[model samples]
Target: MEMKTIYFAGGCFWCMVKPFDSFDGIESVKSGYMGGHIENPTYEQVKTGTTDHLEVVEIIYDDAVFSFDKLLEIFFAQIDPTDAGGQYMDRGTQYRTAVFYTDETQKMKTVNYIESIQDRFDKPIVTEIRPAEVFYLAEDEHQDFYKRNPERYKQEQIDRENYIKTQKNLS
Candidate 1:
């Protein structure tokens, strides 16, 4: 039961949790702040985009059951990897999409996965692949947000799906 962790910034940490959580072998998905210059940054601080922090999720998964590559596939599918600003209705530097790799293996996997899917989309992927930095767990209220607020989470999923459908039409 070897466990590994990855950090992802895919706009609205709340929205990022559900897709990964739905899969088996995902031990936990914690909403948090990563890549920030300051310590203990609040949501509002990161939201202002001055903290250089991105709203992110720290995902703990069992690698033996689900390979990191599979996770990357799921992650990429759930996000607008080509969107540099944000995902769906969200916008701002703090909402940018990124994969914070914990090691060289993860880095290689992320880069390779991104390249493999290039032909599937019309635009180039702009999602950042960077070294993992300090990850500060968000407030308890933010953790497992989808589980806590199922209706709101469902609506977000609907909105994202509709947005993606609209985006596909334009391309």
Candidate 2:
């Protein structure tokens, strides 16, 4: 089986894991920091929005079973792509939505997918499409946070779902 890796910065890294975890081809979903200037930034540093790092998830999967396009679809559904500032209740550059593409094919597919869905929203999609950068693994406390802290994670999911519903109604 050929495995491929993709990185996605979609709001709080904690909220990004569970959505992709249950998929058949998915190998692992790890919380990490990317697109940052600092080396080995901690969650505290990135959360401050000063390290220039965005909270991201490093996703590894079997490309033969799970396609990149499917991953894009899942990513887009999780956050408001039009929100340039941040997502849900999290407000910061670190919470912004982005697709960190690792290859030409991933780049092209993401660009096209964004374009095709442009008409669906009144606002322009602001999700960033960029080359994959070094991914610094987040603290152990952050990995699988939803599993570790179910109540907190559930509350976050509720808030995010409500916001998404409201946005859909507006558009």
Candidate 3:
């Protein structure tokens, strides 16, 4: 099986893990920070929005089973692509949506997918597509947050789902 990795910065890292975790061929979904100037940044530093780092998830998957295009669809579904400021109630540069492509193929697929779905939204898509950078793993407590903090994670999922519904209605 061919393995490939890609990074996605979708609002809260806590809320990002479960969506990709349950899927087959998805070897791992790790919570982390990326696209920042600082090295080995802590959650405290990144949350303050001073580090220029975005909360991201490092997804390792088998390309033979899970196509990058399918991954893009899943990623886009969880985020409001038009929201440049942040996602849902989370407002900050750290919470902004982005895709850190690992190679030219991933980059092209992302760009093409965005283009294909552009007409679906009234506002322009603002999700940034950048080359992959050093991804600093978040503290242990932050990883698998959904599983560890089920109540809190459920609340977050509710909030995000409600917001996504509204966005779909608006479109």
Candidate 4:
């Protein structure tokens, strides 16, 4: 099985990583920063929204285990694509929704994915689908934040998971 990496920014990396990590195809989801102008930006820099970077989660997956299209589908389900500013409970450019494609094929795939859902939203989808830029690993405390802060993270995860599952099941 070939492993591939894709970067995404959908909101708080802590909350965003949970859904993908539970999916069948995903191997791992790592919290980090990417698509920013500052080199090796510190957490402080990103928090201030001065850097070009967005808070992102780097996903590792096996192609055979999960198709890129499937990954994109699950990604869209996690956030309101119509919200251009940021996701729920998270506001700022740093929390903007985005899909960071790594290559031409991935880019085309993302375009198609967005097109497929163009009508579901009243406003145009604001999720930026672009080629991925440099990814900087976040501070140690940020990694596996869900594990470290289980009480809070677990509740959020449960809420998100239930919502997505119900959405899919209803459809």
Question: lDDT for model 4, on a 0 to 1 scale?
Answer: 0.85
Residue-by-residue lDDT tens digits, candidate 1, 14-62: 9888888877888989999999799999987998989989999999999
Reference-based lDDT, residue 150, model 3: 95
Q: To one decimal, what is the Cα RMSD in angstroms of model 1 from the true structure?
A: 1.6
Per-residue C-alpha lDDT of model 4 across residues 94-170, encoded as one tens digit per residue: 98999998878778999998998999887899899888888899999888888799998988777767765775598
- Superposed on all Cα atoms, the candidates' RMSDs to the truth, in angstroms, are 1.6, 1.8, 1.9, 4.5
Order the candidates by TM-score, highest first — what do you get?
A: 2, 3, 1, 4
Give candidate 4's error at residue 69 in angstroms: 1.2
Q: What tens-digit string does per-residue lDDT give for candidate 2 at 112-134?
A: 99999999998899999999999
Per-candidate TM vs. native? 0.92, 0.94, 0.94, 0.87
Best by lDDT: 3
How much lDDT does each candidate structure score? 0.89, 0.93, 0.94, 0.85
Off by over 4 Å in 2: 162-171
lDDT of 4 at 18: 72
1 versus 2: better TM-score goes to? 2
